[model samples]
Target: MSAPPATSPSLVLAHPTLAERKHTWTLTQPEWGTALTLEEYLHREEYLTTVPLAKHGGVTHWILTVASAPPDQRPILSSCETLRKRALYSTTAPPGGGGVAEGIAHGVGSVFTDPAYRGKGYASRMLTMVADELKAHQGTLMSPSATAASSAADDKRLPPVAFSFLFSDIGKKFYASRGWVPHPSSHLSFTTLPSRRSSTASSDAAAAAPPPVAAIGYHELAELCTRDESLLRDRMSRLPSSLEAHQAPSSFASTPPDASRPLTYVALAPDLDTMLWHLMREDFITTRLFGTTPSVRGAVFGHPGRRVWAVWTRTYQAAPPAISANTLYILRLVVEDESAGEEYLAEGLRAVIDLAREEAAEWGTAKVLLWNPDGEVEGLMRRSGLTFEAVEREKDSILSLMWYGDGPGENVVWVAGEKYTWC
Candidate 1:
């Protein structure tokens, strides 16, 4: 687990932790913050009505507060997404924990405080409450968006991932300015898109592994209830199906865990297995990719020599041999460490692309799109004689795609693109 923030809180609530100073900071029910049940279904819609008044437009606000003594000198104010804080934490209290899946990420919004509470540490106190909830839910992965600058040295440095927006936003500035990396939303949304081609970064040996592998495994919010009940309860804050159902991963970020129905993955030998995943991540970082994810259903390792990669065929009827029938969508691309050098990376990329190409040919799919956000990756793709077309997106991301023979129509399917919120 990550370390707790420092504030020497005199009286604050947080999840029950090993730290004695920590306590459950429930916003509603005020007393026994930890034991406090849902202020109501998701959370009190206090800010939904107020954010519009703030001129921030469509902002939602919530507060998590901890009691403090006058000696503590922390103020309490309210606003959209406002928090009323007194200190970093409170004295150890009994165990109290609960949450909902949507509340984990979707519920997060801006914060506010009262004028009287300004100078006191109440804002920090309120932040502590929201922060605690975020940790408990295990939902805080920010997709850092990349800006269109030739060099990283440009005036506006792109965040490594998207969550940086949480820190960069107006209300968050007070806390984010301290040390957090502010992210631009436009950039994050772009990188979160799926990738085009994979295999360019393969190590060759792993890429060529003889297959007939079994499915890796499938997970879902429900099935996880039986497998890891504790995680489910903690993330969603309750076991009730209504709340439990929310944690399922979205098309954009994570696939919510389900049992009878769940999102799954095909297991491959270490490097080979992760080739698709790594490639997807690579494009996500570079911001030249877009696609949806499969719903709660996934295939596990089937057998040996069976390759695992996501493709979009106009229809599911396309078999391996007839895969080339549609346009091949690349959700990920492989990348190895730099020491491997230009030659190794080139051969590795071609091998993977070739593999994808063959699979596409079987399905009757044509055209491959691959984008490298990092100039270095793009340069490598170009050096290898891969045909590509450059395109810009919303000023936050860039893309260069390779078009194969016009086998599929413009309406090709995409991997993970089916899932909406995952991105």
Candidate 2:
């Protein structure tokens, strides 16, 4: 009889500890880029030591390695991270009329495989392991309160998490094969700035026209969070109800039978303390990336009581035309004055854009990209004299928002005005 074929090398999943941080950092550098040095990365970790997500079991990190790899070769094959947060789901019941559920949202980023190990199925096996971990952790996520718990238990008896989501730059079909479906409810828009000559002319004419009164002012992210915690929370709490009535039905809507209701939705539920910590962390990253002082990259505009905030970041889209330059990204936008309606929100957005434009000019970029803005917000962008074009969905390498879960996965929307770039 022929000798039995040698068994294939098994892959092992492990979490990097403090001792292995350098190794982990080495694996991520090529994918995350050279702007962030190992020292800066370590500093960021030290600064976020108290961030609520990690403290409360809200985030987890993992790495995969080939158990049988030779000692001389690097064993780490791939890595990813997940974040857990309290996601709110709307209900028809009274008393605030919404319920809070925990979501172990899988970010699944920094998925890099060693070049020598590519085509050997390491990435695929690692993703399968991630899916298994998410499924196992689903039951452990908690409901917000006794009431929400009862409501969730009474409904579909769904898993603790409504869904796990990831923003995939990789091909959609690649993730699809791993059981992730593109979120049809979300889309991206890109706006090109008017020529520099026209913009400069307009600025000079406005300057000559009048000594304009500053009705709206802009402040740093930390200061806004400090001064407007309650207002921010109150405004954030209402986003789900507002979107349910206003946003058009997503093409991907399935389940719920009701076309109007979202299949899955999320808002930033960070408490006052958590928000401050998050902003500080962002400031650190901004300073490192732009060589500007902390908090200079983001601003909150409008009156303190009725405010809008926008954070800026540099991004590169490596699609057609191959842009590898600075592109201003609206990292987060929020309108605090709910009763003021879309027009007021539009005005606030415009003010923030003006500030962003100044910064963009300084950085020598003429392109701006806005993440998933609801229908009302997009309309406001159009009315403000900015022409926006939808980014075509790609089978692979589109900014794919894919989710996995039983509860309204297709209908889930992002309501929290803030976007976590680190996540």
Q: Which candidate number would show the highest lDDT if scored against the true structure? A: 2
**lDDT tens digits, residue span 301-370, model 2:** 5676677766666443222133345466666666666567666676667766666665555554556666
lDDT of 2: 0.52
Candidate 1 lDDT tens digits, 278-307: 223322212211133322122122121222
Runs with alpha carbons beyond 4 Å of true place in candidate 2: 1-10, 18-21, 34-59, 66-74, 91-97, 101-104, 135-162, 184-247, 251-262, 270-294, 314-324, 338-343, 363-366, 392-408, 416-418
Give the local distance difference test score of model 1.
0.28
Please give the CA lDDT of all the candidate structures: 0.28, 0.52
lDDT of 2 at 226: 50
**TM-score on alpha carbons, each prediction:** 0.26, 0.67
